[model samples]
Target: MPSYPGGETEKAAYDLATKGEKLVMDYLNISIFDVQEMPIDLYLFFMREAYIHGNMRTKEGREYLENCRRMEQTKPDRKKIRKKIQEQKREG
Candidate 1:
């Protein structure tokens, strides 16, 4: 995550994740995973926040942000997960 010089980084990370979850839910047309599922979102979000912070700031921040941007640009493969959910429903 983008560690700010002060303690602001934590809050920035949290906000990034929260926004990411919302985007995921909307774009994927699925329910948010439980607490356990949120970790993925949190991880990706931290990277994204770090990247944004890095872009206009220090060199370290920029490097971290670039890495995060690369990660955030990736889309999750939902086909398998959706298929699995469908199968469970069929069996149940």
Candidate 2:
């Protein structure tokens, strides 16, 4: 699961995910379940496309984008984490 930044809660994540899912479904004429089955990269592409072309200048859109940015910032750097783990193992 993706992590949320400071001041972001699970509720906020839920709201964003549901709203984004709805937007994708309406834009693509697909169902929520269909979206659930989409690859993460494809789903993100559609989400970004929707944000760019779907008139996201409104207050809600701005908030959604802000939340998206926060969520993105919280994604762990796997390479850095792995390097740390390896260094620890070598030292021990």
Candidate 3:
């Protein structure tokens, strides 16, 4: 089976400049005036942080899904376990 590397790239997309700007703006949760008031360095710092957090979230999501897939492929045959479902765990 061919394996595909998952998750999106964090590289800035010049073609989506407007959308990127909007993302940064929304990430900061501040008004346009506040954004303009920030220094270039500060703005860049926040934008970098936004992308970092977005990438981390995507990475975690992918890992969770991959784990789920692996578990599905390897689960024990339920019928082989004689224990009643209600007696299986500590909920009692």
Q: Which candidate is the best by lDDT?
A: 2
| 1-92: candidate 3 lDDT, tens digit per residue | 11124433356645664554565688988876787788888887887666555645786655645554555565675764646664676467
Tens digits of lDDT, candidate 1, 49-91: 5446435577766665555555565676589779999999999
Taking all chains together, each candidate's TM-score versus the true structure is 0.24, 0.43, 0.43
What lDDT score is found at residue 26 in candidate 2?
82
**Tens digit of lDDT per residue, candidate 2, span 1-92?**
22235534335333453877877888899999999999989998887677555646677556656666667775787999999999999999
Q: For model 2, what is the alpha-carbon lDDT of residue 39? A: 97
- Candidate 2 TM-score to native: 0.43
Give the RMSD in angstroms, all C-alphas superposed, for model 1.
18.8
Clashes of each: 2, 0, 0
| Alpha-carbon lDDT of model 2 | 0.72
Stretches of model 2 off by over 4 angstroms after superposition: 1-17, 56-92
TM-score of 3: 0.43
Badly placed stretches (over 4 Å) of model 1 are 1-55, 75-92
Worst lDDT 10-window in candidate 3? 1-10
Off by over 4 Å in 3: 1-14, 60-92
Candidate scoring better on TM-score of 1 and 2: 2
Candidate 1: residue pairs that collide: 51-65, 54-61
